[model samples]
Target: MKVLYVLLCCVVLCLNVLASSDEEDDKQLVEMERSADLENRKRLHTTNTFIKKHVKQRTVRGKITHFVCQNAVTMEKLTFMFALPEQNFNEDPVIQHAMELELQREMHEGLDLTEVEVADLAYHEKNMNDLGSDRRVMLKPDLALLILDIILNPTNYEHFDFIHTCRMIGLFWSVKDPTSFITNAEVTPDDNTCVIHHGTTVVKSFQYDDDSIVYVDNVTHKVLNPSFVLDLA
Candidate 1:
């Protein structure tokens, strides 16, 4: 009987130790998770600060009304429009000269163009003479990088307002079905509407109003209304 009691006590003591160890493990896990989350937040804050500082230094003016990007591997194309608020073009020679210098620096660092090719392209496409002309300017890849940078990393609506204000209207078509895609689309900036048509049939439509932007899915026949607020700073 005394031996039986001793065995029972030992078993109880073992269970108590196990329970305490499990509780301690759970507590350590929770603390590790909390520390990880805090570190992630700190890293995010640092990254955002760095991006904002750089964005402020680069002066990107003018509204990119339309942009087209193509995937190199798939040959898929993305054509989009933005209803950006108009601003007077900056004609300050100092700012223009500074922009030219920056463009030269970026070309040297980012592009694989020779010095001669760079000068020729910059003169023809990005010179102040062509920029000030009344005709529409065709931007080459080198100059387009500046606009793409602003579009990708926007600090405010004034920086690039499309993500917040406009609807993303995309059409996916391959070389097989090229004729079925939209050949011509009209962008009405007054009402903020872009309607893509295929042989008189409305393929995709996006409309924006005061409170929200509405997208009509032709495939599902469903309506999506996403709310947006214009941040004009």
Candidate 2:
């Protein structure tokens, strides 16, 4: 019994010593990696030849609207616009990416987000990325991630609304395109009475340095009368 007790005590002390040694080793490794990353960033920033100087940039803007359907019972319309920054046509791809990231950070600051939940839709059930599976992929070949959002209580119209039910679904891929996705949406009220409101929402985004512009336009019309309510979804 005495021998066994001494052996157990030695084993515990050895384990504690090994654990402390491992902790020290991990700390040293992290510090080394952080130092390396900082040095690389400094080198990139100080390199004067990284980005070209004194180049011409072009800014293009346009707007278009179309009526998909117009009838007494239902009406749907679409409109879109874009305002691209003045970027040198032959700018270095890396520098262009840095500029876009800076712009995105500036735009997202102080932005408000609506609460959303994951929606259960039939199309989302199958494994779309499985090459051997029978399910068909719904996105483009270069798309690495996709998200779908659905308003839960879309019919419940309110003035100066504070909250709304929504759903967001995300899909990820092993490989993705190098482009960033940006979108904006707004809802406006017309007048009060037999409330007839016509609002248009525009979604705009910039593609990668090599890709073209992308946008989405949506126009919605709703009439809330004494005995009838027309909602848009």
Q: What tens digits encode model 1's per-residue C-alpha lDDT throughout 115-200?
A: 56543432222222223221112222222344334344456335334432222222221111234544334455655465566547
**Model 1: how far residue 65 lies from native, Å:** 14
lDDT of 1 at 199: 49
What TM-score quantifies how close candidate 1 is to the native fold?
Answer: 0.33
Off by over 4 Å in 2: 47-49, 52-202, 205-233
Clashes of 2: 0
> Where does the lowest 10-residue lDDT sum fall in candidate 1?
80-89
lDDT of prediction 2: 0.24
Cα lDDT listed for each candidate: 0.36, 0.24
Against the correct fold, how does model 2 do in TM-score? 0.25
